[model samples]
Target: MTIFDKFDQLAAARQALEENCGDFFNMVVDDIISATEAVVNGRRMILAGSNNYLGLSFDSDCIEAACEATRQAGTGTTGSRMANGTFSGHVALEKELAQFFKRRHAIVFSTGYIANLAMLSTLVGPDEIILLDADCHASIYDGCRLGKAEIIRFRHNDINDLEKRLKRLAKRNTNILVVVEGLYSMLGDRAPLSDIAAVKRKYGAYLLVDEAHSLGVLGENGRGLAEEAGVEDEADFIVGTFSKSLGAIGGFCVSNHQQLDLVRYASRPYVFTASSSPGVIASTRKALSILHTRPELRRRLWDNANMLYQKLQDLGFSLGPEPSPIVAVRQQDKEEALAIWNALVQHGVYVNLVLPPATPDGGALLRCSMSAGHTAEQIEHIGQAFAAAHRTDQAAQTG
Candidate 1:
């Protein structure tokens, strides 16, 4: 094929998708009121798709910090972090993150994506390898490519698969860095960290846990999967995002490995990208403080999780392997999923629509990510909306 043929093929397929299932995917929102709800098409919607687990997006402290930062620091950082973008706020935020994770050091990035890119690329190289979970977020995959490492994949959360890959890696005389997500974003299932940690130790490989989804949603202190599994010390790297729990924009990496400071200089993702603005840093710092002190917030978050899990299962909708904040309602295909998604929005609810190949199975998924801010009334309304959409789809098919 010609060099441009791949682009032509992708353009054609995307056009087909637009033609057949455009409305559901290309929705426009009028206003977002809170973490759990928004106004779209002049109608109020229950926002079950947002990653704002702690629902601190609208916190007064964060907003005020952002406003103040806007006044003081202006709109953007303008230069790369290696040059002039590294602000005092960035340094303070990294220190806060390190303290939060109880690690020796931390580095902040412009985004959770860049955090993965920086860590994986800096940690793995020509003489090192990267092993990632099959269901990990796309950033981890990109990080492997950036590192130019020998990329290996294990079955999603399968300890046996991880062991198999690690065993193979041991024979190669190369350094191994195995990466996994705290929670699989699409499916909303967490990794078996304890088992994975054991296997990594057995094979003498380093482990990196991307706590993007679980940062403020798991653990007693919300330190994420490793803390919950009691294997925090075993993980060589812990990556997280401020977008979810901290209710801001930025990414961080914390580690007890004394060499983390080296990545600040060696990793292009950290050095080249503009550092997070003061507003984001300030807001995230405040949010982190609240999250640390407020254990009740975590309880409320899990309460929402349990309610959604139970209600979705009671509705006869197929769920993921286990219950967590993110819930996936299985659908037949993209067309059916789009139809259901459209029906739900028309009935006043919003959720993420997952289809092949973003979804592993050929089926589509109506993904719901709950937040602590979601009210009981809102949750009830969402359940009713799901039932309504489910009924309408069945009726349409029957007709």
Candidate 2:
């Protein structure tokens, strides 16, 4: 058989998805009206799936900054940062990121995924050990694979499991890097950072927290979970994405350790990948400033999140563990999940449809991410849409 034969199982799964839901995986957005509204397949839908948490994507200042930067610089940075890609904006943003996080050093990357790739793969070597949460993002796993490190997974958010694994490797006499996320994307549950940090300290392991989904969404200064938990100093590294709350495209790793600056020279992902464009850098910088100054945005985001979460729970839908920006409605049956997802679109709402293996519990999820841009009325309308979609799905099954 050819190498292509290996994809038969995946092809079958995709075919099944197409037959049931008209290719939800590839569903296109015909037009984007705002951060919280879009026209998809000729239907205007509330954008509950997009991870625009702070809703700065459409902010006038951010947009103007992007436009001005694009006009000043070119459309794209044609080279990697190691080469000719390091612009004034890039350097400024890195410094700002470090200052905002109150860290000694910061390294910017092409994307959030690559930031994880660069940091995780480069920090730990074959002789070293990486003890990560079982539910860490795929980027962390891929980074582990890219490196030759001995990877060990502890149970998701289980401090005891993490401690046990750390104890087992205590005598190895090699550097151990502990990796986790500030806010888990799937279930919206938070890592017990304080507990994890305590365990890390006991084991003498370096801690890396991916704050990709938590930046600008948590903590008093919007620094993420580590800051909220009062353990920011314990986290040796903090990796995050600008695509989420910052409303731009890029990733970064900031740390109090001055040695972090060396990752720029060693990380293949950083050395090979082209740097973020001028517009992205400019918009992200503006967004960061706004996130720092406007705490009301964070409050509004939480308000909307709590409202929608309570409404969904009131509707008797199974949901994630906590009420963060991410409100994942869990479903045991994949077919039922697909039906509900389609019903949602029919009711003029768009949400993310996550299926098995990708999902934390090997179930399906109709995931909704809240944004500060969404109005109270919009949140209510979304709840009504879910209710109507559920009713439609139930009627279909009975008929």
Candidate 3:
């Protein structure tokens, strides 16, 4: 058999999707009108799938910072941080991130995925163990695979399951790292950080919380779920991405442990990958400042999220467990989900159409992520679009 034969199943699935839904997966934005609006397929559509939580992408200060940095520092770093890429702006952003997270040290990476790869693959060695949530991000799983450590997965957000696994490994006399996410991306459900932290402490294990989706969306100071749950001290390391809330491109690992500063030397991903562009670093710094100075952004974000979530629930849609920035409507049938996604687009709303096996469960999700930039009227419009889309799908099925 040819090597290409292995991809036959995937190719068949893609063909089916395209035939059914008109290629929604590859739909491109023709133009970005704002943080909450975009032109897709020559149609003005409300953006409800983008993870711009604080909605600083269109902020004048951020845009200006990016332009100024590009003008001054050129377009790209073109080298790894170990070589010629350690710019002044990069150092400054690291210090600011450490200060913002109240950590003693921080390390920046080219992307959030690499940040996980560097930490997870390097921190725990062959004799060590990594106990992670079953529903953790793909990056976390990939990082684990790159490492030599024995990986164990507990049920998602199940404190009892975590404790049981930790207890079984207690007598192994090896280091154990417990990894969890502050906010799960798919279902938008939150981890029981307080409970997980307590179990980690009881098991004498280290804790790592990936706040990729929770930064600037949780805590009074936007320090994420660890801070909101009052377990920051219990968490040994916190990793997050700027692509989400910071409205730029980069990833970081911040901790009280000074050893994190040395990961740059050993991490292959950090050593080999080119550094982020000067403009991205500058815009990220400006966005972080905005996140710190403007608490109202978080409030407005929650207001919009709550409104959309309530509207969907009122319409008898099966939604995620709780309402936050991410509001996902679960659908059991993939064909119906695709029809609804296309109908929503036709109604001038664009959302993420997540199908299995990517979904947390073996179901489809029409995922909507709220932004502070979304007006109340825009949120109402999104809800109406969903309602209309559902009706159209049902009518098609019945007809």
Candidate 4:
């Protein structure tokens, strides 16, 4: 067969998406939009899927700081962190991360995905073992693939299943890296941190919690799920991204072990990649300060989450396991899932679409994310749009 044969799946997928793309209400917003109501195609569409949990992307302070940094340091780093890429702003951001996590050692990477890739790939060699949550982000899976470690998976949020794997690892390897997420992105449910922590203790495997979705949204000071579950100090390593609640671009790994600093020298992704620009560091600094001082943001985020989740459920739509920053509606089938998604877009509502292999356990979902700035009325509007889409799908199917 010619090499072009490999393009079948990719081509088909693109065609399907393109055909339905025009019907979508939610998409990458090119304009500087503030508040939930914005003119898209001259229609006021409710923004729901943006990862800006704190709505800091539009915050004046963050935008001004970025502008100032651009004037002072220029637009790009012009080099990688390993060479001329490292700047004073980068050092300050690293320090802020260390202090925030209360760990002596912290390393910042270009992106959250690269942070996991660099550290996990560099830290684990041929002699190590890596056990991960089944629902972990693709970065974790990719990082493990880059390393020489044997990858093992445990059931999603099932501590009993994790304990079984850890026990088996203990019997063979003395060193193992156990990975789990603070909050799963697709399902919007949390892991059993306390139970997983106990398992880590019994087996003596190092635990690394990915707080990409939970940071600045969980715990008293927005430390993350580990802190909320009281396993912060006990965790061997904690990794997170600045993309979501942090309102910036970058990733961090904080550990009391101090050995994480060594990964700095060995990680290929870190050594080869360009460092984050001055603006990212500056804006991230401001966002972190707000996260630490303002507990009200977390409350507002959850309040919006609960309001939307309850509204969806009351509309007779099956929801995810719990009320989380993410809300996924159970679609009866793939066509219904796509139809409901397109209808929601037509109604000026944007959310993530997940189906089959994309979702866990071959299930399909219409994933919606909540932000702190979202209001009660806006959330109800989302539920209503989905309900209307559901009815539309049902009517079409019955006909």
Error of 3 at 124 (Å): 0.9
> Which pairs in model 2 have colliding backbones?
none
Count of clashes in candidate 2? 0
Judging by TM-score, tell me the better candidate of 1 and 3: 3
Worst 10 residues of 3 by lDDT: 20-29
Off by over 4 Å in 3: none
Q: Against the true structure, candidate 2 has what lDDT?
A: 0.95
Error of model 3, residue 256, in angstroms? 0.3
Candidate 3 matches the true fold with a TM-score of 0.99
Candidates in descending TM-score order: 3, 2, 1, 4
Cα lDDT of model 4 by residue, 1-399, tens digit: 989999999888767766755544335555546845565566567878777788887778888888899889988898888899999998998898899888898999999999899877987788788889999999999999988888889999988888878877776856888899999988889999998888888888889999999999889889999989999977888999999998889999999997788888899999999999999888898888888777898999999988998888888888889999889887757777888888887877878788778788676889988999888778878888988888898898899
Considering summed lDDT, which 10 consecutive residues are worst modelled in model 2? Answer: 20-29
Total colliding residue pairs, candidate 3: 0
| Cα error, candidate 4, residue 186 (Å) | 0.5
Assess every candidate by TM-score. Answer: 0.96, 0.99, 0.99, 0.96
Residue 131 lDDT in candidate 1: 86
Which residue pairs in candidate 3 have backbone atoms (N, alpha carbon, C) closer than 3 angstroms, thus clashing? none
Model 4 TM: 0.96
- Best-to-worst lDDT order: 2, 3, 1, 4
